[model samples]
Target: EGTVYRQIPDLIFEADYKDRWIELQEAADPWKCTLPGELQEQMKPFQRLLFLKQIKEEKLITMLINFIQESLGQVFTEPPLFNLNEAFQDSTCTTPLIFVLSAGADPM
Candidate 1:
């Protein structure tokens, strides 16, 4: 006979909690703006795919960071004096993937 293992139960939050949180979010950003239709129409198929890919990648990185912090009880820090040129030049070193979280608009 095979041994049976019990599955872990999922977390359950209060009823209406999700709805109330969503309402608060909508109230905070009532505009609920999105990419302009004109700009979206102008984007090529590849461009649209690339944009979606970038968003998915951002979400993935955030989840990974959160998981690491929760499991290890420590936040990961960016390495100091990270030289892109040197990293790329090394044959043994794997190229690191970089995601731009934010960038300030250039002054006119």
Candidate 2:
């Protein structure tokens, strides 16, 4: 007999991290109201931090997706065959298996 398995990942979010992101958004909002030249110097560090964080997240996601694809490619290189009689005849044969994995809205 063939068996199917569904896998869901455990995701954890920190309250402090969420709060810090809100704070950054609040601090950056004022720059939009002020003149570019007046606030450019003051906002440079915040802008830089946000940009670097975005780049890091993008790279991490890309790496994760690549890793998952490579692993799956290796695992499922051959299509599985399901035969009840053959499985019984061959002592080495075990149950056939299938895995279904899903990701969330964010690629992680």
Candidate 3:
């Protein structure tokens, strides 16, 4: 329905708990496999897809928030966490629903 964070379960298996950039980047070519050539060259401006995906990863995200908070000082509280609905509204968005999991099965 919305922008799919991912389709392949393996890519998402531990993502909610741990960081996955180093792993996914290393999974293939690390440089080109996940991204296209232009984005690799542009450095600042990125492709929409990569931008969306980047907003979702935790490590990259925290770094972004830290950068903003560090620069903005007391005004900013935290960095943004990737919420399908929130990215548009919340600017200094950290402390998102993350690093968590649910267990056991419920009969469907």
Candidate 4:
């Protein structure tokens, strides 16, 4: 009589592989339907539940567009032109004015 070892069935290995794949998917997209902690806490319970469900069902880009349009309406308005020379005239002014321009757009 020699040593006898139990061999694991291939099906068991396949099932374990599937389980690990599912776990990896869950780990990868942990924030799929989550809101920032403060915003979630501020929402009413029933509204929060519905919003969570709806956001999961909705296309992310669509939700982002709606949020930007509804929450940041002022961004669509024309920005006020600044008189840079007058703004920097104060000797005590230590703040820097930064310009964000599009490609090929001259700052001057």
User: Which number leads on lDDT?
Assistant: 4
Q: Score candidate 1 by lDDT.
A: 0.39
Sorting all predicted structures by lDDT, with the top scorer first, yields 4, 3, 1, 2
Candidate 2 wrong stretches, greater than 4 Å: 1-66, 71-79, 91-108
Best by TM-score: 1
> Mind giving the per-residue lDDT tens digits that candidate 1 earns over 1-103?
0111111011014443446434533442222223232323454434433443343554444444444454465545344676668766653546565545546
Residue 71 error, candidate 1, Å: 1.1
Clashing pairs in model 4? none
TM-score for each of the candidates: 0.23, 0.18, 0.21, 0.23
Candidate 4 residue-pair clash tally: 0
Worst 10 residues of 3 by lDDT: 28-37
**Model 3 Cα lDDT, one tens digit per residue, 15-97:** 55234445444443232234332333444322333453453454455444444554566468645565756744554456444
Local distance difference test, per candidate? 0.39, 0.38, 0.42, 0.45
The weakest ten consecutive residues by lDDT in model 2 span: 1-10
Looking at model 3, how many pairs of residues clash?
Answer: 3
TM-score of 4: 0.23
Error of 4 at 16 (Å): 68
**Per-prediction count of colliding residue pairs?**
0, 0, 3, 0
The TM-score obtained by model 3 is 0.21
